[model samples]
Target: MSVINKMLQDLEQRQPAQVTASNNSKVPAAASRRSPMYIGMVLLLLLVLLVGFWFSKNQQLQAEPANATNPDAAVRAEPRQPAPKQSEQHSTDQAAPAAIIAALDTTNTAANALSESTTASAVAAPAENAAVNLAAIITAEPAKPTEPTAPAPLVVVAAEEAALSAVARPQASVDKQPLSVAARQHNMQLRANASEAAGDTSAAIVIWQQIVALQPAEAEGYLNLARLWLKQQQIVTASQVLLQARQNGVVNAEINMQLAQLAVRQGQWQQALEFLSDQFELAAEPEYFGFKATVLQQLEQHAAALGWYQRLQQLQPEQGRWSLGAAVASEQLGQPLQAHQYYLHAWQYRQALSVSSHNFIQQRLKATEP
Candidate 1:
């Protein structure tokens, strides 16, 4: 019984030691599993912390620009200017081109009106302020150049008016010779007219003489100078100047008529007839025909005299003298019947004839009727 007991005790002690050893081995395996789990948990916590910090920093960075822009946006908005929309900016950009296109299309009146309105607005708003504010939105426009509100001083207004008148007045009275001969002549004429208006007849005469010197072929200058001489009662001087003008190929009807009158005064009837004959078609005066008829009748040219008398009567239909002259011419041409008819017509307009003409016409009418 003692031996059996000793062996059992020994077995029991060995069993206990073996069990403790197994427990120690199991503890090492469990420690390995627990360490891997702890490492994974710590790595997960670090990744979560890093992700949260990165997210917070990114949010702060994004919010800073917005916070900074707020005050600037408020300031920009204070001017009552609406922020330009993308669509409106594009429309404004197109407005200038549209105005140019409308201006080019002259046939389209409505388009032209629209273009005018658009141009006015563009000039007032965008074109004027474009250099100042690139982001400005176009709106209503001003129409014309701005005028000063307060009335200017009378002296200042008068000065401005005088300046304007000076600018607007013709520069013809200046003594400066223009490059063009025609311009010089015109200026000289204006100067002469001014001198004449100022009662400086001698100055006018001198200027006209200069004009005649510059343009010897110009008839008006000679005529003006001759008329000035005539106005001064210098008939001899007028006659010489007119003759010079005629020799210079300045043969106007008025100059010829003056020459004819002077010749008549000097009793050069033939020379007067020569002057008047050349101007018959050119002149439309009653005295020219009358003078021609009187000269022809005095020279015993009854046939030619009759035609002139007829023309004078046609021109002066209300006068009775031409009828009596026509009757006398017809009687000399041996047409007593025609003379009697003209004599009757002359008697009907006896008031237009002198008393001596009326008595002569009545005696001619009585003799022709018999």
Candidate 2:
């Protein structure tokens, strides 16, 4: 009975010890499970940090190569701080794991602050690098040179004018050549005509003299000069000019007719007949025939005057003056019957005669009746 009671007491004390031991064993098991979960979280955090660091480093490396390739970009880039020494980098890497561990061991709020700080640093570092690269690229480009200004409008116009003047100088000089003989004579003739029209007889005479001097063979110049001299009642000058024209071998009919008229005006009837005799080719002309008939009558050459007046009467049958002239010439030559016939013919055209001529013809018809 004593042995059985002692065993029961020991079992009771052992049972209490066993319960405390089991409780101790359960605490170790819970602690072990929680440790593995904490280790996985720590490992995940470390992986994230390593990935962030690697991405930032990759961006930095890319930027460095680009900057090296372009000297201008490198020059424009913000001056970079010197790279850390190998030992310093190594020490920093070693300290990073310790800092992460410390953050994990701290309160949750402290760990969260550490994570936010790390994230902000990672984001800011890339942004700063990108800003630096953009600045370098923008500043490295070359500045464009300014364009040259154009010449002023006034200056360009002046240069053009100068060029045109240079081209035209020779042409203007060419146009200044002397006029030809015919052209000069024609211009002088026009000036003479203008002076004559303006009643400037002396100026017209001077111009005509210049024309005659220029071309002495031109009959028109001598004729115009003689006409102007006669207008001023310069009979001797006109006769001299006409005689000079004849001496110069001018065969003008007007010259002979003008000399005949001048001799008749001076009462030199025989001289008028002699002067008219040179133009025998003008026998067909009524003015020449009539003037020759009148000169023969004045010189008392009745037979010659009768022939000319009868020929003139035939040529101009409607003229009463020609019939009267024929009658006078026939009466002078003692042909009374022919004179009476011409007087009757003259009376037939009485309306063509002047009042004085009609009275004379009436008296001649009565006196010369057949």
Candidate 3:
């Protein structure tokens, strides 16, 4: 029995060994079945990873051109990896593609923003250059000259007349050609005379000065200017105007007569005689003979005075002044008979004489009776 128990123990040990082998073989078959599932899971994980990598590559390819222009875009385009958890590997695998897609979207957005900024800068650069060029062109051009404004009318005209007078004074002697007075000057002269008639001496003086400035070589303007000046008691200014007239080659009989009259007023007999000398053509004028006769009588040259008076009487037969002048000079030269004949001739026109002269002539006629 002991021997049988030993064999049985041996069989039990054999049985345990067979069971161990079966369990080991079954474990292998089950492992084989689970292996395909793990393989499939691994293949799916690999596919997901490949797709994520492809999307990352695609996003990189798209971002390359933008990164070339903007270096900051390259930094923004790099993919970021999250820290993986051992328990959440499947969950991590599923989220990887989504993250990759999100990164691609971010990279695309950055590239688009970079491209838009570059375009804006390009457009703004040209606009700024155009503005700068316009400013430079405006700066390089020459400035236009402004036209001179006209001066005021009346005051400036008066100043111009004064300047013309000053300039014309030195040239008066050399310019002998008589300047023709314009019709405008003549019209101005008429206005001046009208002002004088209206008792506006100041206005008349201003107009006459303008007329003289217009026609410096004309004797009439100088004469009128002198007359107005003398009327204002400006004797020196009147004399200066007459001298200026002579300097302008105005040696006419009227100018000489006015100068002689002025000299006579100043009690300058020699100067007056020299002004009315024979150098001037004074023969045809009856007044010239009369003035010379009076000047000769003042010098006590009774014979010369008598000759001039007789010549004046022949020229004006019925005038009482000529007859009376001849009578005075003849009586001074001691010819009583000729004097009596002249006194009777003057008595016929006694109404022309003043009251004192008529009384003197009546007494002389009674005294020198024939």
The candidate that wins on lDDT is 2
lDDT of each: 0.67, 0.74, 0.68
- Model 1 residue runs over 4 Å out of place are 1-201, 278-287, 314-321, 331-337, 343-370
User: Tens digits of per-residue lDDT for model 1 on 35-83?
Assistant: 3443343333334334433543453354344335555533443343333
TM-scores for every candidate against the unseen true structure: 0.42, 0.56, 0.48
Residue-wise C-alpha lDDT for candidate 3, range 1-370, written one tens digit per residue: 3423443354445545645765877755653354344334334444544444454445445455545555554444332212242235446545544432333223335545544654564466456545534543343222323565665667789999999999999799668775556768878988998999999998998998898788887888888888988999988889888888888877666777778788889998767777766554334777776787787888788898899889778777687778889999999999988998898888787777788878878998998987
lDDT of 2 by residue, 267-361 (tens): 78787787676355534567876888888888888888888878778877888788899898888878888999998888897777899998998
On TM-score, the leading prediction is 2
Name the 10 consecutive residues with the lowest summed lDDT in model 3: 78-87
- lDDT of model number 2: 0.74
| TM-score-superior candidate, 2 or 3 | 2
User: In angstroms, how far off is 324's CA in candidate 2?
Assistant: 1.5
Supply the global lDDT for candidate 3. 0.68
